[model samples]
Target: MDATPGVISTLFTNAKVFTGETETTFASAFRVTAGVVDWVGDESAATGDITVDLGGRTVLPGLIDSHTHPALIAGTAPAAECFPPAVTSADDLVAVLRAHADGLTDPDAWVLGRGFDDTKFPGRRMPTAADLDRVSTTRPVLVWRCDAHSAVCNTRALEIAGITAHTPDPDGSRFERDADGEPNGVLTEIAAVGAVAAFIPAPTRDAQIDALVGLGEELASRGIVAVCDLLSTRIDDPVATFRTAVDRGLRTRVALYPGWDPVAPLADLAAGDREGQIRIAGVKVVLDGAYSNRTAWVHEAYPESCDHGLRLVDDADVLAAAEWARRNHVQLAIHAMGDRALDRVVELFADAEPWLDGIPSVRIEHATIVSDDYLARLRAARMSFGIATHTVFFFAEYDGYEKALRAEQVPDAYPIARLYAGLDPLALSSDRPATAWSGADDVMLSVEAAVRRRTYNGIDFGPEAAITVPQALLLYTGRARLLSPLEGVGQLAPGFDGSFAVLDRDVFTVPEDEISAVRVAETWIRGERFS
Candidate 1:
């Protein structure tokens, strides 16, 4: 048997291909050479090379996570760190914290932890100063909720930050207080959280790079080939740390979008760079908070006080930023979680319509609360991005519709199928470290949530709003590749980058509930196996 014509080493034959666009049964054999697919068909001329028959397992393009904050995972906490509501007793919480702290070399270093649930405690008590104080009196401790919008600090930590009853609330944030106006050590939203964050020591650039590399390795193991990193970068050099990691041989393809600043540090890079794997994609602006935290800027009133949530960044600021980004031909992936915030983002896009000649298509990140009308508008405008995988994880804790969301807001805001139906560019992601959200977990868990619209408790949240299994996979792969808008990134085709994952089981064939059980057995990047 002569070498299969142009085949490199092997041909992944006999596997069903979910080509990222449509499911196909005719793709019986495909050849991978030099890291990219050289050919796909029923007949190949070569026969001497190795061929691993897949029997009938499904094969997909590599999964892509469009949003992630991996630094939070690899630093400060163990992978098995306990998330709240599951571990109820205060004593158990202390034990968990102590166990985590035991691994750290820095004794006086702040023992920061995250992913606690407020609903799990007795009386649904939010961890108070006393609760955190009991964990470690000698060291200052701060444990943030899974939402990343709230945190409980110990007395020592509070003292270090000088937060007390007398301390005025910081702008754009709120400190949850007790009856006497005393700070209860719980900081809410960005405002109150920003106050204490100002006092915490900033991680060095080397540390940031380490965290990124560590995160990249972890995701590679989980079969993620590309990611849109939602990291907050410095104004002067947005991609400096990321570029350092790439130069140091980090394997994952990263498309970076830094927080919006007037200076536009990455504008020059975007202008000059045409490379796909490592590029500056856009400007990320936060218009409001997240749904789980109840800080999203909604047009309708929230049940808590019949009040609309606060807008973190004003529309004027968003428009100015959008205009600048458009003028520079950079895309804008604005973070708009609230309905009102989504409205504001849409308006900003509208404001830039005349100048969009040179601009990249705009995308809206976490439009979690967007209405159907607005979604149609986005579709009409040809703006992309319906990224909402991480939000589905928040519903894992709730039991029913009314309990999870108030009566009037029964639909719960995240309209997955609507985006799909409207033919928008929806993507899947895990806003890690900020949320207990994970990319590996999203492939299975979030897909089921999107397909079934069922919460972990088995209650149907919105079955009609659910997306299909095929559509979910596309979001994770094809739509996600658009992050770098990297040419030939996600699909397994000639002229495309050779990046893919071998699965332990076929994801599409599995029972919807058991989808999360499938694991990645192998991952390859640029034609070389990374894991």
Candidate 2:
């Protein structure tokens, strides 16, 4: 239960508390009153109705994954998970899907799975319709790539969607082809993926709520109290879905950003939309694809071909999105993963006036390839911008990046140290299932990647770009909150939210290579023992 104004304060003492005020400010005790922080200092100076000893554990401010796709992850709960380590090879993937298909009571029901990184497959081969046909020829099978921008369906699945040799590719997406004109079952971008996904059955409202409640517990266990559902539109009627989920005991606070579709925009907000822990915060536009898939719009062409990748949203589309955000008094988040896309974003929004102050006017999601020139232009621009990038992307999908990035562009990928020095409100997020790695949302994994600058294959990505433990923690905590809609969060200072996590081991003292081994023992939210 949430603490009230008149509630007696409880002092938690004898712990190493990092107040998030600065890298070196350690307090021995803290008092919580009315579900918010009241004081933090030496244990002898603390006063409260009751005192509890933490036995010298390490406590950090509640973690904020400023960019994640929890709503989409929950919405797709019915599908079998096919993420990496467990499903590393193509044989492993086929076996997992085959088992899922065998357990189906309904013979004709679609056999669905997600999270496969073709880049990690031996020889970098993607799964095809023929590979999925081994699972079940009669039943439709569809499995998504780790990036979530694409999928590969079995022949039956393609047939159900009426996609064949005669079917032209959708407006902004493509179907990988064979020697002839037939689709090889690989669908690129949402338009092509949606062609088959529209046939897959969506979960009912009750199921949606149940899944969200479960996901909330999982997040709490990982010491996350808040997240931004960057792509909430994947769920039908996101507002009602999240509202019901929260009402059904979901503890994590969510900020929803419905995708902006030029043809079919989100419905106008109702009274209930803005009244609860879950609320619509902004609009998201997919300006480009991800690096792992070799579709991120770039200035340089892909090594062999003259293909410079794709531009999902045009200048006019972005301008219109900016206008809509201004009219609705919300933030505009552009998914610009490539250098070219980043340049275009600045050009589109640089002259626009902000709707509010104290926070960024616009946000760039996955500025994956920001160069020195781009950073200089950003600093000179009139508009205010925040960036939500990922180290997990390079850590998990290094093989893909090894192929996609030119030798000269390698260091420019997620320059954490440079970003830390140059940008305010710059955050490092997991991007979860969209990332190729298993347990992608685990804060420790991203932390280790940032500190080590090492990849899954044990390759040194960019050692010079690495940062210290304190600087990385600030990115996940205090600095991250600037991009969050939740105020007074991501800190342990006076007047801040009384939410924090106790770790099983001392993360700051752990060896650089062992950082990912640290675990959360307790997660407290609003002065309550949550997990």
Candidate 3:
């Protein structure tokens, strides 16, 4: 149950509390008054209105996922689960959809699913409309790629969206076609996919709220207390939807970075007074797509193809967004994954240095591929940008990346340690749903990948990029605040939000491989236990 404002207090004792600043720091007890930590000290000095023994459990500041898409996930909750690590083959994917279609009562309603990785399929080829048609020719179907940058739609869906061979490919995106000039139902990038997505029935506001509420509890159960909802404006009126979620009892604190497009004008969303557990911290701008989909806009050509990935946004648009964010006193969280994209972003930030004052630090989402020269350029520019990346992708989509990029580039894929070495206040996150793996949302899984530097198949992609257990923990806990404007979080100090995760064992002492298997015995948020 939630504590009534200003009337609740509790004391947690007999636990090893990791303050998150260092590996050796520990406290035996803490008291929460209302929703903030009132005191933290030895067990003998603890006192509160309500006291409970923790039985020597290990506790740490509640985990914060620096980047995620809760609204997008909620909006697509009706879709069937087609993420990799769950369904490995095209046939398995079809079976999952068939089962989902059979259970749906609406025969004519569109069937939607997300998180399908063609690279994981046995044939290593994306599923086409014909593949989905095998499940249902009558019902329109659209399944998003794991990257969410591309998608495959069934014939019915294509017809419904009016995407034909004659339809001109939108700028920065294209429609894959057959040799005979027919739409193959494969849409790449936001421009192409959004064209079809615009026609899909929008979930009701209540449904959206319910999806967020359910996801909040799910995240809380996994020991996540807050999330930086990257791309919050993917849905119309994200601010209102988040407000509704809070009213409906969302346990996780959210900091929103609505996507910034000059055409859309998100500066208005950043205006007005901030509300409880929800704030527009910045603007999100995507300069490129995912590497797994071969659209990351890298400097070099892919292994098999003589083509570097695609650049989704123009330089002029990115510069304009950066300037707008700076003027509005908000952070600009640019998504630049590829080497070429990072180069462009670094150049743009360097140019925008004049207006950067008074604004929160800029953030680069998914700095997946970085070279030594790129790092030197970033350091030379001395811009106030932080990196919020994911190790889950390194493990989940290792095969696809390995197949696409040069063998030498594999070790530098995530570059977790290297990012920390250059970018002060670096943070880590699981770009869940955007990643190929179903466990992308799991903190332990991300921690394990970051620490072990190994893929799911135990392939060492970038052992040199690995960090210590404490350093990895800081990415999700202590250092997360650098990526967002959320205060009184990422620590257990006095006046901080009384949020912490009670673990079954001390993760700091556990064997590295055993990290992912560690469980959250309980999770508390704002003076109340939710999971």
Candidate 4:
């Protein structure tokens, strides 16, 4: 993980840095050379091989996620089927898959699990393939349900993918069937879980470069140097698997993006002219489906159903992929959770707003349902937002898709206090394997659900959509520095990138329900520490 050559080693002295448009505290002492920030507010003209004091604690800027899926929680297996959080019967999720297949001794190899919140079980149903053949009718499983859209598999993984009950349902996805029309192994979206996740296998490219180098050392032990990879791997080349995990260093800075491909990994990132260290930068577009599975694409209807949602792309291919991502300058996130896929993604970015050439901004990912005339067309097209605060801690465990999205649009759910009294600037993302990927306790449970919009049933589901823990740490840091604000990214100034995040306590002086118990006492990143 080299690349720092011309000077400075590491300094860090008694810190506090969070200066992303200040709230206070610039009282610093940085100096991380060869990895940027060659001196941020003195400390005896900073020199270094490693100094580190930080006793005064608090140094942020190194969290930027802006939508993830880093190879599904960069798994080393055991993500207990993603987020079942609590099983509460289907024999308590077949005894959590028979104690995760009794620590697997190869009961037929493929036993991958995933998060499973069928709206907190008990009849929010979904698990059949005879509920994973009651946990291994001879292995072959497939779990995934907390909303990585959908998947359940099991009659020995639907007879090893031949998916019976006379298959057919794939177009734009959905294959559950039932009432005697059979095929009920449950699988949806990505055209019915991309035909059984294209028959499993895929992983290797050196196990996707050891799961993107153990997901960049688990986001540099949770201080996350930079991110925005936005999950995608059916493999047929993700820019040669991110240039073989950025020529093997995989140190994490990756602004990657690729998925929703009508063939666009842009020819080996213009045959490697996108320079490397994993930065391809742009092209996401989910277009709808996922408000915890009612299948978000709404323009009403949802309450008791009669389905008026689910539009996974197609408004003439969202105006021809927003005019081919504005004639190829690229960058176009666009997931849009609903509110009619965020008003047809603001009418296809206002019909590609006169071919947006210079590419300043353009993102949407989970811009969870907004509507004050689409927050005034995203503040008159100044557009950019990633939002996903782990669905406010997944509606604080209440469920049934938070009672059918509070009975259909409880005034636009993910509205973090109208994006903090709207002056527009957003980024926060944690859509990991669809929520709850560890480290930094999910960014301190997204700063205690954006400063207590209180859920875990204690109610107040939108106390004016609360916000403030320094505006949820500037939506995971300076509006995630507009996804690569000239690469120094999210902040902590000087030549940037010294990478921080220590936090054991003092999340802006805690007490927002004890900011999810703090604890991440070390993380660093470019300057190294790791965790």
Candidate 5:
């Protein structure tokens, strides 16, 4: 349906419209005027210049991914995909990568393959430099582990980085060594991965902009109208790059949280950049690594391991990041995935008042583990903090969680129900390509995982904490908005942006087990069809 901004209007009828926070949760129809929701009520009362029947499909407020990494996804793409349920073994990985390398035209092009999980393999064995060398001898090869926390590279890539037996391990990260203390090409954590990755040619600005445009279409297919790039500064110029992508028809509205760097700060936000579809909402500080690699900064040691996990940032650096957000009049987003890191954040913010109001002062990217005392302390703190947690983490990394978490800690992992009842701005988001699952960005997959509390392999994660459909929807819509700096979004009410998704089936009535199979049929943005 097409409509004039202030004159012509469009009425979408015969739908189970969920106006997230409207007078009625379920409306039969909605009217879009001036490219925004002008009215939403019973079909009998909807008056507009044009009417289109929706055939009784389910319509929801446009979905939001509160903590995805689209720029990261785009940046890592065009590499040979190495994620499972296809690449099941180390042998399978070698075959897939070898085929990818064989297909490439450039003999010297970096053979980059990402997404492989060795934990799910027969003996929990990771592929090594020797295994990757079978794929190529001349070209540099670096394949990231499914968790994105570490990577294993071929000898060529290692040699190119100038890493050898004598190179000392960086704090919180290391290069896995062999019997003779030789760097074995297993780069553990971002510091190790970047050593070689920084040598790879940066994607051309045009290539990156093109990738963003394509990523937007991909997002629209999943019913996402808005997303937050949790770590955007990984690119050359995040703000400008995303702005260009939006101008070039990137469908998803993006809120960027450039990584906090004391030495190299983000360019000052333009007045216009502070309040648009593409905006610089804040800066991100990754406080720790993830659980899959046993790097989540847990309070206790992993089973059979003395490792308590890696805390990547120091207190001074994190406080400095907070100061930057306060000084720049933006928010601070912290990636704290373990109880120890969460304790650090709770301690850091407990004494300070919220730097901003209306929006959350601080956004916790992954509050993976929270205790009763931790929750109470966070609530008692003067600073307001929101949580953007993920169920997909457990869904995709079940074996890792099984290995890393103690028996008593299992129920506490992403306890969506507890967080729902306790946190106001709490939302569930897909960490995406960063996750091991192939369709980690699929909203229904995460919803099913949350509601069923089951892993992909049918193991129960924490069924006692499962929530209802409506609650999960709010995390992806109404409440998810609280995690974003973008305004006038994540709702279907009169004043909200005219963006929504039409589902192929009634999600509210679907069998809990079948929810993962549900698909989005249509998406609308600003009262116009998106996909």
Candidate 6:
């Protein structure tokens, strides 16, 4: 019961300890000393200063979210929730916005909301500024689509941003307008959204830290002991924010990858500061946009659309960034979703293979729409690459993918089995607020989805793409550790960090569909109980 680090000794017995490698093998007990596993064996061989029984519960490696945007999620905490799960129609969305704006004392303050999916609306139409204008004409309102690739602003918000019929669209993005050349209040891609985002009030450093600390506790409660903050610099100083969060008693370990915009400061940031629970792992680059928003840069066009998705970063820019990461000996986490984007990324890696000798492994974030040919190319190249993907999107937002992609493409939407086909290391993540459902952060929910390949509507999306429970679990545990530069974590073996989660039931023994129902009874990080 005394789950604290720096204890002389602690023994955990009478539990099924899943080693994260195989499902059939287990140890009944483990001994921890000074935040490290001293020994793991049968109950008869256990020895420690204090002992407690787990009552035949299950224990596994503390979960690691290989890819997530904790900083962005925290930033959105102060905003109103207009996600599809909460609001189904444009009227419902307007009501939520009105309620949020009404609760705000500042009449002039912007009312911001996120996670809106117009595809799920009763009319299957995106909400326009006109729809939001129905909520409030005085208050400027901004709401992001679920993918964060698009957004809708009220007429007041447009006026505040100085966006008018004469305002030319930013490069790489477009402003949806009516037939008469009037701004429709819908903005697509980051370039367009950033224009209006400049007018929105930024969160204070103290507020950012608090939001991060709260997020850390939330992760710990879900049995997440560590996370790779894929995009860390949404705020001013991400490193300082993470350090402050740790100082405020955030037990979750963090590995940060700052944006690779200028590309000069990355080497210094990676070399100068490597302290506390945070480390600068590498640089992050977005090669393309999200599939849900019809901007994933696919080789083939969407169902009825003439053009493929957008490519956010140029191909040359991606290669140059890779070269810089290679020279600096850091990882390059490229966000690529469509086949074209992945192909370009694979080619870049292939070209940079010799330079990648001592560098950290390159990562492909959200490799959602990979093709077999590209997968073979990746395999043939024999490069040190990692695929950090999510099944939460498959379960939560398959409807959107179904609407945009061809029926044949749906089978490979996430492609967990195919990604693992060549025995490549795969790391699963939630992508948090970007996901379709509220339970995106729940590892068990993702596990069940990956194993069952079922969507929220109870339809089988891709049965052949389904993986076993153990394979899915490894994506969050052993396999995930390969993506991380951290050591002595993500396993329950001797010499590993004494971090593990005690589950209310043995997930390995339960039916696959019931995996999400499994709850974490206790979560320990560095032998200290966090939840």
TM-score for each of the candidates: 0.88, 0.97, 0.95, 0.34, 0.97, 0.95
lDDT of 1 by residue, 1-531 (tens): 234465565566667766675534236566666566666656354342557666666667777877765534433433334464445555656677777767778777776777766665566567777887777787877877766667878888888888888898765567888899988889887667756756655566677677667777878877777777564453125366666877777788777666775444344444445354566666677777766656677777766567676677666667776765666666677777777787776665643453333223676776665557776676666454335444355445452123335554555456677666664456766666555433424466677777777765577766767877787877787656554465566676656666777778887778878876778777778767788
Per-residue C-alpha lDDT of model 6 across residues 38-100, encoded as one tens digit per residue: 788798876688787889898989999988888887666668887757888899889998888
Q: What lDDT is obtained when candidate 6 is compared to the true structure? A: 0.81
Taking every candidate in turn, the Cα RMSD to the unseen true structure, in Å, is 3.5, 2.0, 2.8, 21.4, 1.9, 2.7
- Report the C-alpha lDDT of model 2 over 30-92, residue by residue, as the tens digit: 988978888888888767877878889999998888899987887777777898877887788
lDDT (Cα, 0-100) at 376 in candidate 1: 65
Per-residue accuracy of model 3 over 494-523 as CA lDDT, tens digit each: 879999999998888899989999989999
Q: After superposition, how far is residue 92 of candidate 2 from its true place, in Å?
A: 1.2
Q: Residue 140 CA error for candidate 3 (Å)? A: 0.6
- For 1-531, candidate 5 gives per-residue lDDT tens digits of 233455988899999988777324888999888778988888887678989899999999999999888888667665777777788788999888988888888777888888898887778887889999998889999998987779999999999999999888877798999898998889998888988888887677888899899989888899999998888876777878888888899868898888877566556667776777788888899899988878889888889989888988899999988888898889999998888999889889878988887788899988887767678888888889899999888898897788888889887888899888888888888887788788788999999998999998999998988988888988999888876677877889878888899999888999999998999999998889989
Badly placed stretches (over 4 Å) of model 2 are: 1-6, 271-275
Clashing pairs in 5: 5-34
Q: After superposition, how far is residue 204 of candidate 6 from its true place, in Å?
A: 1.1
Over 1-531, each residue of candidate 4 has an lDDT whose tens digit, in order, gives 122466547778776667665556464677777666656775665556768788888778777776776755543234465454455446677777778788877556666667666666677777788877877787777777755767777777777778777777765677887898888788876678767756666545687677777777766666666777665543445656656776776767666666655544334346553345565566666877777667777776767778865676677665555555555555667777767777776765643344333333467776666756677666666444334344444444446557556543555677777765673446666776665232323677767866786655566665667777877777777666654432675777767776777776778886789887776678776677777
What is the Cα-based lDDT of residue 180 in candidate 6? 97
lDDT (C-alpha, whole model) for all candidates:
0.65, 0.85, 0.83, 0.65, 0.86, 0.81
The CA-based lDDT of model 1 is what? Answer: 0.65
Span of ten consecutive residues with least summed lDDT in model 6? 351-360
